[model samples]
Target: MSTSVGEAVVGVILAGGMASRMGGGDKPLFTLAGRPMLDSVLERLAPQCSRMVLSANGDPARFANYGLPVVADPVTGFVGPLAGILAGMDWAARELPAAELIATVPGDCPFLPRDLVSRLSEARRAQVADIALAASGGRTHNVVGLWPVALRDHLRQAIVAERLRKVALWTSRYRTVSVPWVEGPIDPFLNVNSPGDLEEAERLARMLES
Candidate 1:
């Protein structure tokens, strides 16, 4: 998917998770550096997308202040991030008809690069890939990816009948391309999954400032 400025590239923040590890609180709403974690994620992704949506299972009103549409998993029972991705694809197919691809980023990944969408989109286009994933330190970050909306049916089938919803597994079925973001002082794809991770993110943020 070749995405130019102003083109219809939908950004989906995957927030539909049970943050059991971090004491069961909403991970995205958790504060990092005196700001909601989602705020930093949205700040990085919003500029690169034509429209943005939050995929959360809980009440959408909680995210009303963000002024972005919050989508719940159409298929219930708390299925994984794949459910969120499917929801995003469905939303893009229905609402943003012109959108060719849905770019997904985890809500806890506050350090995602600002050029994430552009880089992934360009990689997908160059490689003629159906899915484009991010990589840091030689590890593929499958959740941070861009998926073609055209594969909506295949995804839905995989989720419904087979109960196979892992992002990496589904992505492997397609012509997937990985875009490398070489390591630096701060790994751009650092995700805060626990309290300790939040603390580390703060330290990294300070390091960036210094």
Candidate 2:
């Protein structure tokens, strides 16, 4: 399979959440179907990206084996997924200077679409949008998106000056497009936020594997 669409695109798995709903810990690290959930996400996303990084906080040792860089939120005080997205952008700017864009997907989501980066890239190019986000079942997955690296500075300004918190709020200022995916047997953006959700993911894993 052609894993990379272009050398100018990088992937970032947003994993910085406090995971309070799962009782305070790394939700991506939680085991699902006998494997770490993040591993499944990486498997699907890494091939599509020329390079990939993990947007996470705390000790990076837990993810040491993955070999991908773990970037902490540049903005302090747990600013949510948008912070993670910004961190990813900054990392791409610094490490992959040739990269034009960064694609983000929540680490807790193991069933991310295999064509995620390419479809988002195509949608953004076709629409001439500043950003391209994933949507399913009539709901937008703001955390799962394609962001222009050029927007990093502006995003930093909004976060610092306006205290921007919501992804939709900041994205509204730019020309953005949402690529809707069909909810097959299950939503590709399905994420694990709680213990019960993990159980459901495990069940989904079995179904998808078969």
Candidate 3:
């Protein structure tokens, strides 16, 4: 297993969302530059993580070719990304018992930074915080954060007992830090939410390729 700052780290791609904005169905399956969006994500994240899993529901067969384990939300009713986070923690705890942390990234973001895990680990250590999230262009991407496996129980309590949905709201209750990244022509955190956004991402992809 790969280690981020001497601690084994696992990566989880949050794909459990119902992409109503993009007319539904697997948004990660959508192509970017003739390859699946998940392919881009995997390509960027694979080097940073020892093992990776997809936090997705429904038929796992859809992602069978990727070969990574597909975990459904542990909580029922599509409890949002928090559920995915908790599920990731649970999975890592079970499958990757040696892993000290799990880092999460959105599935639709094809341009996630190469230094994502190391930077977040550095931010978490420097700030002495329980969690560290990515921020770009003065905006924090709550879902794009590093979570400790030890906090899994508390997260479950927050999601189950308190009905927590908003990621920022839940993260607010913890010691969280945001690691900022320099913005260039394209933001590493740029994600595809709509068809227009996908087209824009395609343009950015071409620019990146060139």
TM-scores for all candidates: the values are 0.96, 0.96, 0.97
Cα lDDT computed for each candidate against the true fold = 0.88, 0.89, 0.92
Error of 2 at 100 (Å): 0.7
Q: Which of 1 and 3 is ahead in lDDT?
A: 3
Q: Which residue pairs in candidate 3 collide?
A: none
What is the lDDT, from 0 to 100, of the residue 69 in candidate 2? 95
Off by over 4 Å in 1: 1-6
Q: Residue 80 of model 3: what lDDT?
A: 89
- Clashes (candidate 1): 0
Error of 2 at 11 (Å): 0.6
Q: Please, what are the lDDT tens digits per residue for candidate 1 over residues 11-85? A: 999998788888886799998888899999988888888899999987788888899989999786888999999
Q: Could you tell me the lDDT of residue 16 within candidate 3?
A: 86
lDDT top scorer = 3
For model 2 the TM-score comes to 0.96
Could you give candidate 3's per-residue lDDT for residues 1-210 as a string of tens digits? Answer: 464566789999999878899889999999999989999999888788889999999999999999999999998897789999998999999998998899999999999999899999998999999999999999999999899999999999999999989999988998999999997889999989999999999999999889
* lDDT of candidate 2 over 1-210, digit per residue (tens): 233566578889998888898788888888888988999998899889888899999999999988889999998887888888889999998998988898999989999989998899889989999999999999999989999999998999988888989989999999999999999999999989888889899899999889
Clashes of each: 0, 0, 0
Better of 1 and 2 by TM-score: 2
